[model samples]
Target: MIGVLVTFAQTGKFDRSTLAKIAGELRGPFEGMAGLRFKSFMLDEEGGQARNFYAWDDEEKARSFFTAELVEKVTGIYGAPPTIEYLDIVGFVDNSGT
Candidate 1:
């Protein structure tokens, strides 16, 4: 599996409610996305960072999502370019069902 970590700095622009709203808005684009296994939306309120962890079926689709247009959009939202990291998903565990 391919794992992607997309991190953006979120300062005063997005409060908790607004962040939740943005997350909700993104759900539509993520839904029914081919090769997307799962996505985790994260917030580091203290550090002022918004993060997204995406597990994909392959590298191609993972890279495909980070297009030029997407970079521009994210930059506009965050007021800067995002820090993106792509890694191989070597291991994992799921306890959400419990």
Candidate 2:
């Protein structure tokens, strides 16, 4: 599995409520997405950052999804460009019973 960490530095450009609302509106499209194991939208208001963490069953699919176009689009959404990092997922636990 692969983990993708996408971070946006808000720097007072966005508030928690706005980021939450954006996450709510955008999450639906990720539901049932191919090669996606899990996705999380997170906020750190005190740190002025927003992050999206994704676990992918296929690294290629994950890489393809985060294209330059997508970066530009997300920049427009978050009011700043994001820093994306891909990591090797060495351990995972799922207790949700889905």
Candidate 3:
């Protein structure tokens, strides 16, 4: 699997509600994306940081979401640029109870 990780800095004005809005927008589109396996997000409010990890079936499928337009859509609200890292996911663990 291909993994895309993004580190974000939120706008000073963002509260929990603003974070929820950004999460909703990302989830809405990526959930329907072709070849997308799963996506998970994390936030450190005290540190003013957010991160998302997405697993995709292939590089192309992953790159589709890394475009400038999409980045703008998400980071624009924060008024900052996000740092992204793309890596090949060679292993994983899923412990969610069914």
Candidate 4:
């Protein structure tokens, strides 16, 4: 598995409501996306940051998804560029079925 962390440092550029609306609007497209295990949208209003954590079944798909065009589009939507980080997912625990 692979983990992609996308962070947007708002610095007062965007508000919580706007970010939440963006997340709500965008969630539908990712619902059954291929090669995506899960995607989480997070925000820290006090810290002035919004983050998205994506878990992918493979690195290739994850890498391919975050292209320049996608970044540009997201930047336009969020009103700021993001700092993207790819990480090796060593382990995880899923208790959803419990």
Candidate 5:
């Protein structure tokens, strides 16, 4: 399993509703993706940051989704480049029914 973490500094002009909508727009299309096990997101208002946890079968599968179009779309909304961290998950517990 692979994990992708993204942290962003919010512009502060956007409200909670807008943030939720943006997150939905970004993640909704990934629902049917193959080799992608799951995704979980966290947003911190105090820190003005966001994190996304992605579980995939391999690194190649993860890269395939970070295409030019996706990058453009994301940068257009977020304004600044996000710091992404990729990791190999050794173990986990999921009550979400994997």
Candidate 6:
């Protein structure tokens, strides 16, 4: 599995509602993405940040979302370029039983 962490740091003061909007807007496009096993949306009001954590069965498919154009678009909205980190998944425990 491939683990990707994408975080957007707000370049200014913000509120909880803004965080909610960020979470919704940013996550909308990647919902039900191909090769995505699972995704989690995160918001940190005090930290003024929004994040998306994804588990992918295919790294190539995950990488496809971080195109240069998309990066520019995201930066336009977030006020700063997003910090994207790709990590190896040594192990994961899922008791959800889906």
Candidate 3: where is the Cα deviation over 4 Å? 10-15
Which predicted model would earn the best lDDT? 4
Worst 10 residues of 6 by lDDT: 10-19
lDDT of 5 by residue, 2-86 (tens): 8777666667643567678777887877788799888876677677776567888888988777777876767678775666778
Cα misplacement distance, residue 52 of candidate 2 (Å): 0.3
C-alpha lDDT of candidate 3 relative to the true structure: 0.78
Task: Please report, in order, the local distance difference test score of every candidate based on alpha carbons.
Answer: 0.84, 0.91, 0.78, 0.92, 0.74, 0.80
How well is each residue in 1-98 modelled by candidate 3, as lDDT tens digits? 89999888756634677667777876776667789888887776787887778888898888877899978876776567788899999998878865
Residue 47 in model 4: shift from native, Å? 1.9
TM values, all candidates: 0.86, 0.93, 0.78, 0.93, 0.80, 0.78
Compared with the true structure, model 6 gives a TM-score of 0.78
Better of 3 and 4 by lDDT: 4
lDDT by residue for model 2 (1-98), tens: 99999999965855778988998899999999999998999887777889899999978999999999999999999888999999999989898998
True-structure RMSD for candidate 5: 2.3
RMSD of 1: 1.8
* lDDT accuracy of residue 19 in candidate 4: 77
Poorest 10 consecutive residues by lDDT, candidate 2: 10-19
Weakest 10 consecutive residues, lDDT, candidate 5?
6-15
Tell me the deviation in Å of residue 45 in model 4. Answer: 2.4
Native-to-model Cα distance after best TM-score fit, residue 31 in candidate 6, in Å: 3.2
- The sequence of per-residue lDDT tens digits that candidate 4 reaches over residues 52-83 is 99999999999999999999999998888999
Model 2 TM-score?
0.93
lDDT tens digits, residues 29-69, model 6?
Answer: 66776788888877767787777788998778879868999
